[model samples]
Target: MMTSQTTTNGRLSKRVQEIKPSGIRRFFDLASKMENIISLGVGEPDFVTPWNVREASISSLERGFTAYSANAGIIELRREIAAYMDRRFSVQYDPEQEILVTVGASEAIDIGMRAILDEGDEVIIVEPSFVSYAPLVQMAGGVPVAVGTKIEDDFKVSAEQIEAAITPKTKVIMLSFPNNPTGTTMNAAEMHGIAALAERYDLLVFSDEIYAELSYDADHVSFASLAGMKERTILISGFSKAFAMTGWRLGFVLAPPDLLAAMLKIHQYSLMCAPTMAQYGALEALQSGMDDVERMKQSYKQRRNFVVKSFAEIGLECHIPGGAFYAFPSIASTGLSSEQFAEKLLLEERVAVVPGHVFGEGGEGHIRCSYATSMENLEQAVKRINRLLERL
Candidate 1:
C-alpha cells in the first residue's frame, strides 16, 4: 500500500465556528475524573426508564421493528402524543398535520429555529435557560437576544421585558418553563401575558415545555394552550425529563401546518426520524406511563424539599423550585464568582455543581445544584457545600 496525503480546501461553516460549547459540560467532565465526587451538576433525572416503558421498546425490537419510520414519525406515536397533550394540558394538536417527531427536544429546538430564522433575525431567549437554545439559534443564522430573569423576580421573564426586547427584526421568542437550571415555571396567567406579547409583536413563540410533567406546586401551563397562540407557537416537549427516558432520544413538536411542514423538511434532511424503538417506547409512555410520571415527580418533589430546606438552614439563599430537579442558590454571601464557587466546592469538598454564570450573565453569583441524586446523596452534598461555604 502506498502512503497518501489528503488535503482539503473547504472551510467549516462560519455559523458553527461561532457557536460555543455548553458550559454545563465542564463540571461533568471534571467530576468524571475525581474520586468520590458528589455531582449535583447535570440536569438529568436520577430515575431509570420505567419497566413498562422499557418493555414496550423490547417488544418493538422483538417484532423486528428496526426499520425507519416516516420522516415525521410513526402515526400512532404522534396520535398518542396529541392525545396526551389534550388530556394533560387541554392543548389540542392535529397529529396528522401539526406534529413531527424529533431525535430529542434538542433537535426540535434546532429544527424549529432553522425553519423560521433568517440571517440576523432576533430570537429573544429568557435566561438562565438550558444551555443549548442560544447557540442553536446562532448556528441557524439568527441572533440570540437574551432577556435576563433575576432571582428577585423568581427568574420569570415578565411580559414587559418581552415587549422591550422586541425589535423589528425579532422573529421568535423562545421560552422554557418548567425551566432548566433555575427550576422556575410559569402559571397560565403568566403564559397568557407572554402569548399576548408575542401576538402583539407578530413573533413566533418557540415554547420548550420539556419539564411539563415535573412541576411540584402548580401544573405546567403550555403557551400553545392560550387562545390564538396555537397558530404562532411551536411547542416542543419530550419523554426525557418526565418519563426518565433521556437515553431514548425521543421528542416531538406541535405547530401549525405550514410551520410543521417547513420543520419536517429540515428534520427529514438532518435526522430521518426519532429512533424507531424510542418512538415506540414514547408511545407507551404517553399512553400508559402516567403513573410512572407521577411517581417520578413525587420523588423529585421530596428531593427538592430536602435540598431547599437544607440550603436555607445553612443561610444560602435559595427558593423552593416549583419544577424540574435543580436548585439555584445565590452565592453572594461567599463573595466568590459563580465559577470560583463551583471550582472551590469541587476541589475542596469533592462536591460538583454548575456555576450560574454558565447558564448566562444573569446567573452571576449563583450556582445550580440538581437534586436528581438520591436523597442520601443530596443530603451529603448539601452538608459538603455548607462546610465549603462556612470556610469562605
Candidate 2:
C-alpha cells in the first residue's frame, strides 16, 4: 500500500500515485483561467436545478430538518427511487432492502467496485468510456480489461468483443450507454447480446445509466430490465444529469438485497449518507420533475443536431450521437493526435475540448466535445474549431 518514492510534502499510497489526474479537468482548468474561453471539456449540464426541487430543500431547512437518515437513505427517498425505477426503467427493487443513496454516481461506482472486487479480480470495461472505471477498479484491487469499440460500429461494444476479453479472473462487466465521450446508445436487442454473455459467464454487471433519461433516437433499455439480469446487476443513476442537479450531489444504487448490504457497509463507514437537503431536493425531483427533464432533453437534442451537422460541414467525421450531450469527432484528417488537437484548439481558438485518448483505447485521433452548453456557445465554439481546422 505504501510507496518508497516520496514527495517533498509527504509519502503517498502507490495506488494513488499510479492514477493520473482526470484528463477532462486539465483543459477545463486551463480554460477557466483564460479570458473568453468556450469550454466543452466538462460533461456537466448547464441547466440550473428546477425551482420546485430547490424550494423543497428550502422548506425542509425551514422546518429544521437537517439530520442524517438511515445509512441506506431516507425511506421516503428510497421508496420514491424504487417507484421511479419501476415506472421509468421497467425495473423493480424493494426500497427497504435494495436501494442505497450515495454522495453521487461517482461514490456509487467507487463503493460498488469495493463491495464486489477481491484482489486480482478482473472487470471488463467497455471503452472509450467515462474516465473513472479503470482507476476505480485498480483502487479496489481489481484489474480493468478494456474492450474497445469502433466508431464504425457506432461505438457500441458488441457481445463478441466482451466475450473475447473474459477470463477465469473476470468478475464484472462495467457499462455506460448513452456514453460519456461518445454519446452512443445500444438498444434492447443490442444489449441482450451482452446480457447473454453476462449470464453465460456468471459475471456481475455494473450498469451506469446516469444518462438514461436523455436518449434522443430511442428509449434507453436498462440492462437490468432484461430477463434474468436484474438478479446480478447493480444499477447506478442519479438526479444530476436528468434533473440538472449536479451541484446537489445525490445518486442512488440498486442491487439485490445481499449485494446492497455489502455496499451499505462501505457507505456507513466512509460516507454516512448523502446530503440531507439534497435528498429532500431529490425527493421533489422524483415526484414532479419529469417535465423539466423533458424540456432539457429537447434542448440537448437540438444542440446535438447542430454540433453533428457543424462537424460534418467543417470536414470532421462525427458519428451522429444517439444520446447524451457529447460529439466525438475524428481529428485524424488534421494529422494531429487527440491531445495535440485539443491543446492547439484551446490555445489558438479559445475553444477547449477534452482529448479523447484520456478516455482510453480507440479514443486517440479524436476529441470529445460536450454539447451541454448553450447553443450560442456551441455555435461560436464550432466556428472557432472551423477556423483552427482551416489554419491547419
Candidate 3:
C-alpha cells in the first residue's frame, strides 16, 4: 500500500511523529470490520442515554437555546455541577470561579496539563491507567514518569512508590482512582497517604474521577476531598460513564481560583464552550440522573460479579475490581504474551478484548475486559474465554 510518493507525501512535526498511536484504539479498529465480533474492548456504556436526559436536550432545542452561552458555559449548568460535587463528594467548589465545563474529560485532561506545564516539567502517573495520561503529558511538553501498581496492592497506587518516582522536576501527580484498565479504587486511608505525599512534595494533583459513581462495594475517596488537597487537586469528571452520555461530549474540571483561570484561558480559545444542547443534557443528568446511574450501576455490578466469577471458575485469576466497569485478569498462567493471547482469542472465538500491554509495561501479562455490556455478551465472552483457556 505504500509507495515513494506516499512516503514523501507530508511531514509530521517531530512531536507528532514521536508519539505512538493509542493502544486501546488498534483492537477497536480491527474489531469494527470483523464479522460476529463480540467486543469487550471499548469502554463506553452499552446503555442508551436515559429518556429524561434526551428530553432535556430536546426541550432546550425547542426553546432555542442553540447559541453558545458563555466561554465558561451556562451559569445554570455550572451551578448544578458545583452542587452535585458538594452533595456527592463533600468537595465544595465555587461555580463562578472554580468550575469549567469541558468537551468530555479528554479535553479537561489536555487543558489541565497545558495550563500548568512548562518545558521539561515532570508528571508522575500511576499505571496501568487510561491510555491518554502519559501522551497528554508529552504533548504538553512535560516528562511522564509512570509508577506501576501491582495486583497485590489491589492496584491502589502506593504513595511510597510515587514519592520514590518524584524528581526535582516533578510538578504534577495525576490520580485515576476507580482507574481505567484495572478498575481499582482506593479507600480513604489509602488516599490519605497519597495526600500526605502530595503535601510533602508540594505537587499539584489532577484526579480523574469520571468513574466515581461506578464503584461497587467500595468507597471512592476523592483526592480533592482529602485533607488539604482541594487547593492542590483539579478534580475532573463527566456525565459519560455514569449518565450514559458519552456522545454528549460533556465533562467538567474543578480547581482552585488561580488554576481554574489558567485552564479557562486555554479552554476558551480551544473548545469555546461545550456543545449547548449537550450542556443542557448534562445539566438534566446531574439534576435528575442519579436514578439512571443507580440502575446502570446495579447492572454493571451484576455483570462484574458474572465476569469475575466466570474467570475464576475457568482457572483465570481475576482481581475483583472495586470500581469502574472493567476486570483486569492476568493472562500469565497461559504462558502467552498479552498480545498473543488477545490476538489468538480474537481469531479463534471472534471475541475482542484489549491486550493489557497497550496500557503500559505493568499491563503486559494481563487483559482489560470491560463489563459495561449486556449480561448475555458477558456470558458469551466468558464462555469463549473459557474455551480458549482450556485449549491453552
Candidate 4:
C-alpha cells in the first residue's frame, strides 16, 4: 500500500509522510503465503500463553469484569507489575502514577516519544536495532540519528559512539538491550558508560526491555535501576516475549509521574486503555508465571546452541548471542548480500531468515535467524541453510 506520502492532497503530516514501513513484516508476509517454509525469520516465542494466565482472563470474563478500566489500567494489574519490577530488577514504581498500560510495548514506544519530544528534537538510535525505532522517533517529530555497533563489539553501543552522535538538539537515547536482530545484552561496564553519558548530558532514555526475560548467558540489566537514572528513564516491557502473550496485546510503561502523565494524556485519548482481559492475563503472568518463564528460556537456550553450532559447521562466523533467541551470522564470505542470501535461501532451500540489511548499518552482510521456534524446526531450517551455503 502506498503511504500518505503519495496522497492527493497535503493532508498527511510531514512527519507521517517521512516514516517507512517496517522491514520485518515483508519477509514474514511472504513466508506466510508459501508452503513448506521452515521460517526462522519471525522473533515470536513458540510457546502458548500459560494455562494459569489464560484461565485468569477467562475467569475475569466469567465474573463479567468487562468494562473500561482506568486509563492507566486496572489497579491490580499495575500493582502487580510494580511488584514484579521490584522483585525482578530492583526497580520500583508507584502503580498509581508511574505506570500506564498500553496496547503493547509498540504503543508505549510511540507515545513515550511523543510525550517527550518537541519538533526536531534528536533521538540517538543505536543499530542494528529494532526496525521500528527510527520510524517511531520520526513520527514523534524527532530526528532519529542512527549510530551503529559492530560484531566485534558484540553489537553493544559504546559510550563514545553515543557521545559522538549527540548534538545540541539531542534529547533522548532509545535503548533496546537483549536487542532484537542481534540478540546481545549490555555488560555492566557498557551500561555504566552509557549512564554516565546520559547523566552528564542530561538526556532522557527510552528503554525497551521487552526481551529482558529472555537473556541466556548474561543477566538483563534495567537501565532505570542505575543510580541517577530512574528519574530520566522511561522503560517499556510486556508479556509478549517472556509470557508468550503476544496476541493478548498488553504492555506498560514505567516513568516518572509527570512524564507518565503526559504520555497518559495521549494514551487515554487514543487507546482508552489496554485490553481489559489482556491486562487480567498479564496480571496473572506477573503473579505466578516465573516457572513458565524459566521453562521457555531453557528451551530457547537449547535452540540457540543448535543455531550457533550449525552456522559454524557452514563456515559462517556467528557470535554466540548473550541473550534473546536470535543469532546474527555474517554472510559476507558467501559473496551474497544479506537480502540476496535470504531470498535465494528461501527459494532454493525453503528456509526463511530475515536479511540483516533490513535492520540497517552494522546489519549489512549478515542475516538474523530466530531460534524461538521448536527444536525440530530449528534443526531443519539450519540443515537447509547449511545445504544452501555449501551449494553456493
What are the runs in model 2 whose C-alpha is more than 4 Å off? 1-10
Model 3 per-residue lDDT tens digits across residues 287-314: 9999999999999999999899989899
Which wins on lDDT, candidate 3 or candidate 4?
A: 3
- Candidate 1 lDDT for residue 362: 91
- For residue 200, model 2's alpha carbon misses the true position, in angstroms, by 1.1
| Candidate 4 lDDT by residue in tens digits, 1-392 | 66665564377676676677777788888888889999888778888999999999999999999999999999999999999999898999999999999998999999999999999999998899888888888888899898998888888888999999999999999899889889889866779999999999999999999999998887788999999899999999998888999898888899999999999999989989888888888888898899999999998898888889888987999888988788999999999999999989888888889999888777999999988888888888878887888798
- Per-structure clash totals for the candidates: 0, 0, 0, 0
Runs in model 1 with CA error above 4 Å?
Answer: 1-10
What does candidate 2's lDDT look like per residue over 244-361, in tens digits? 9998889999999999999999999999999998999999999999999999999999999999999999999999999889999999999999999999999989999999999997
TM-scores, one per candidate: 0.96, 0.98, 0.97, 0.97
Give the worst 10-residue stretch by lDDT in candidate 4: 1-10
Q: Go through the candidates in order and give each one's C-alpha lDDT.
A: 0.90, 0.93, 0.91, 0.90
lDDT of model 3, residue 194: 84
- lDDT for 201 in candidate 4 is 94
Error in Å for residue 177 of model 1: 0.6
Every model: Cα RMSD to truth: 3.0, 2.0, 1.8, 2.1
| Clashing residue pairs for model 4 | none
Query: Across residues 120-213, which tens digit of lDDT does each residue of candidate 1 receive?
Result: 9999999998889889999889999999999889999889998898899999999989888899998988777788887788889999999999
**Candidate 3 stretches greater than 4 Å from native:** 1-10
- The true-versus-predicted C-alpha distance at residue 111 of model 4, in Å, is 0.4
